[model samples]
Target: MDSFKHMHEWRQNIDRFFGESFWNEFDSILKPNIPQINIYRKDYEILCVINIPGIQQIKQIRCEIDGYHLRLQGEIELPAKGYELIQEEIIQGSFNRAIELPYRCREDKVHARYEHGLVFVKLYKDVHDSNKSKTISIEEGEQ
Candidate 1:
């Protein structure tokens, strides 16, 4: 009987230390990675396929290209109103994902489309003279 009392006290201590919000934090950490992406590079274009479920409209996602990087920002929402949640494994929230490209992409030639819970982004490579040099201006700091 004494050992049972000690075990109960230990469980209470652990519960107090973890609190009620611990599962929320744990769920965020343990949930699957959102907006999983796959990139493919061809000779002059790059194709990026992203998995983003629960998007209601295409306007909910924003895609951008910066130099050799592709940025995706969006929110995924699941309609769960007036219903009890027995279990929650799907992640639904705002996400911002940045992916590095193998080469610089042209900003003006970028194309993006969303379909069937997936986002497809196609970017054209920026073909420029890499050997060209430009002058840099330097400003003196406190010496």
Candidate 2:
């Protein structure tokens, strides 16, 4: 009876080893990259916070928002280059990430600020009244 119990538990463990969660964990360890980001949404606006370390200059980062998509591009420059790399968990080099926001944002009202090692972005949501209707005049194309 004890032998049968052991076999059952072993089979369960083997099944778990081949599960999606197990593979995801293994994949992250093998290729640990990309900056971590958190986003919050409200009726009027959306807020995004990005975690970036070892940033030398704020000018190195660039952010743009078009429609519902936001793109981030930056690099983390190593302070000392001569020393042999022993262990590195922090990802360096130029990284770009594009995220689609839940709501359509007003590009003209987008604001961004970088402080310490985190970037804060505030995007205002576009306001459109469903009951209102308007007509647009067609424009002739330039020759």
In order of appearance, the predictions have TM-scores of: 0.63, 0.63
- Judged by lDDT against the true structure, how good is candidate 2? 0.70
Q: What does candidate 1 score on TM?
A: 0.63
**Superposed model 1: Cα runs more than 4 Å off:** 1-32, 129-143
* Candidate with best lDDT: 1
Clashing pairs in 1: none
Candidate 2: C-alpha RMSD to true structure equals 11.9
Best by TM-score: 2
Each model's C-alpha lDDT? 0.72, 0.70
Scored against the true structure, residue 86 in model 1 reaches a CA lDDT of 89
Candidate 2 residue runs with Cα over 4 Å from true position: 1-33, 128-143
| Candidate 2 Cα deviation (angstroms), residue 87 | 2.0
Q: Write the per-residue lDDT of candidate 1 for residues 5-109, one digit (tens) a residue.
A: 999888678779998566576664677567788999888989888888887666677777777777778898888889998887666789887788998877767
lDDT of 2 by residue, 10-115 (tens): 8679768886366466655776556778999887989988777777666677677766677777787678778988887777778887778897777666667666
Provide the global lDDT of candidate 1 against the true structure.
0.72
